[model samples]
Target: MTIFLALVVGGLFGFVLDRIGVTNPSIMGRMHALMNLAVMKTILLAIGVGSILMFGGQMVGLVDVGHMSVKTAYIGVFVGGLLLGTGWAVSGYCPGTGLSSAAGGRRDALYFIAGGLLGAAAYMVTYPSVKAMGLLEKIGGGKVTIGTVPGSGYDGLTGLPGDVLGIVLGLVFVVVAFALPERPRKGEPVPVAAE
Candidate 1:
């Protein structure tokens, strides 16, 4: 049932990405160039809505806090994020969008997926050596959340209530998304997929 639900959700997500033009490399490239903000607005809206619902649920005791997983922070995490951003900008495909793009019949997205797989394999093969170099060492015990979790020592940097903080930040994102101009600037070329 869980797998079935995941497939349905994944399909829906892909459909949304496709409909929003995120499956196109040209659109993504223009987003990176700041020539387009549709993708950014969409992402911000998602984040805002998700954060609000998640934190609101927690506040109402409707969500299971125990099920939440927060990744440990470390140098490698930052380094990995930088690499991921670089890959996204260069290849014009993040993992999720890349998969969706490939599913939508983009040949270049397939190559992106192949390169990602190779990169993952290389990382796995070099894990031991990387660990030995202290790349995986936990800094300050690593695991943390933006807000205080019951029975956990980590209260993040601000030591604020997580749910409240999440809601505030989420609303901020929502506002920013709405504030962005939808139309391209004068003289800006509209992005289009190449034939």
Candidate 2:
């Protein structure tokens, strides 16, 4: 049942991604170039709403706080994030978008997928060596949250209530998403039309 639900959800998500034009590498390129902000606005809105729902549900006991998993912060994680961001900008596809693009019949996304797989394999092969570099050493009190969440086992960096903080941050994202212009005001680039 869980697998079935996941498939259904994944299908819906892919449909949404395609409908929003994220499956197009050109649209993604324009976004990275700071010429278009439709994708950025959508992303912020999604994150805002999701954060609000998750934290609100947790506060109301509708969601299980115990189900939350936090990864330990390490230097390697930051470095990996930078690499991932660079790859996304260059290839115009993050993991989710690459999969969605391929599923939507974009041949170029297949190359992106292949490259990602190769990168992952390389990481696996070098795991031992990477670990030896001390990049995996935990930082920021390891696995701590930004604010204390009631019933969560992890420590927090601040005494602020996590649920409230989450809701506030979510609202801020929502506001910023609405505030962003779809195109840069100065020297506007050609508009991205649907393919």
Candidate 3:
């Protein structure tokens, strides 16, 4: 049921992305140029809310902190995140969002889609080799998350009580977002609906 609901919600979001014509490179480019903070704003809100809810659940013991925790080691994770960030900055879209945009008649998005597909295929083709040869063996205890408390024994770095911090960050995000200037490109019709 949870998985089903997630799929349904994800589909709705994709539909919304499509309807807003966010699949266009120009739209994304223009957004990066200053007329939009849709991606950042959306992500930060999700993170902020998610952090608050997770901590709240844990504090009230509604969720199990032990069974639902993750390990945190940052080497591969940091590298992977760096790569993802680089890709997004270069192409102006993440994989899922890029797919949505390509569907909206953006030609560059096609290349992006192709590149992603090829990358996936290559990974699939190499998975056996990666595992059989133990390529990722060095990434010990790979399932890390912020909540995944480890042997450090909560020496003040525990983020569980950080819901207030998340809320404060969220509020700051909202305020700073409002202060940003919006400038539309020359010759393109302004997105009146977005205002």
Candidate 4:
């Protein structure tokens, strides 16, 4: 039953992403360039709502917090993050979104998909050396969260949880959404059609 619910909810999420043109390369590219904040704003909204619900559930004891993934906060961590941001700006898509766009029949999305696959393949081929040399686990660190580990008898953040921060942050996005004015894309003259 839990798995079933997860599938249904996941499908709805994908549907929303597709409907919102998140699968579009142009939109994602603009976001990477910092010209469009829609993607970031949407992400914050989702995170905010999800965190609120999860924390709310924990409060009522409807669900228990689970173990978090291991932390790897070494130098490589920041380097990888910056590289990802740079690549996203240059290529206009994250791995998953690039694949999504490619599947949706966008040509430029193909480049992103290709790069992602190449990176994955490279990782697989170098995995042995990476692990042997400790390069992979170099940045592995603490849990690094506001809450206690599971079974420690302490619930995750209660009221004013991390989600509340997201909620507040999300409001900033909402405000910007209204404040920003839309403009035509580059090389797309507003009078092109009329001319």
Scored by lDDT, model 2 comes in at 0.90
Model 4 spans > 4 angstroms off: 1-7, 67-71, 128-141, 147-195
Q: How far is 64's C-alpha from truth in model 4 (Å)?
A: 2.8
Candidate 1 lDDT (Cα, 0 to 1): 0.84
In order of lDDT, best first, we have 2, 1, 4, 3
Top lDDT hit: 2
lDDT of each: 0.84, 0.90, 0.61, 0.62
Q: What would the per-residue lDDT of candidate 2 be over residues 1-195, giving only the tens digit for each residue?
A: 999999999888989989988888888988888888899899899999988998999999999999889889999999999999899889999999999899888899999999999999999999999999999999998898889888889888898998898889999999999999988754755555678
Candidate 3 lDDT, tens digit per residue, 39-137?
A: 445555555565556555666667565544444543645665787777776787778779887766678888888988898899889878756764455
Q: lDDT tens digits, residues 90-124, model 1? A: 98999988999999899999999999899999999
Candidate 1 structure, TM-score to reference: 0.86
Q: Each prediction's TM-score against the native? A: 0.86, 0.91, 0.57, 0.67
* Model 4 deviation from native, Cα RMSD in Å: 5.2
**Clash totals for all models, in order?**
0, 0, 3, 1
lDDT of 3: 0.61
RMSD of each: 2.6, 2.0, 6.2, 5.2
Local accuracy of candidate 4 as per-residue lDDT tens digits, 1-195:
999988998777667877777887667766665556666667655665665665555556675655324364455567678989888777767776777777778798887777788988997898797668655554323334344434434333333344344345556655655565444244453333423
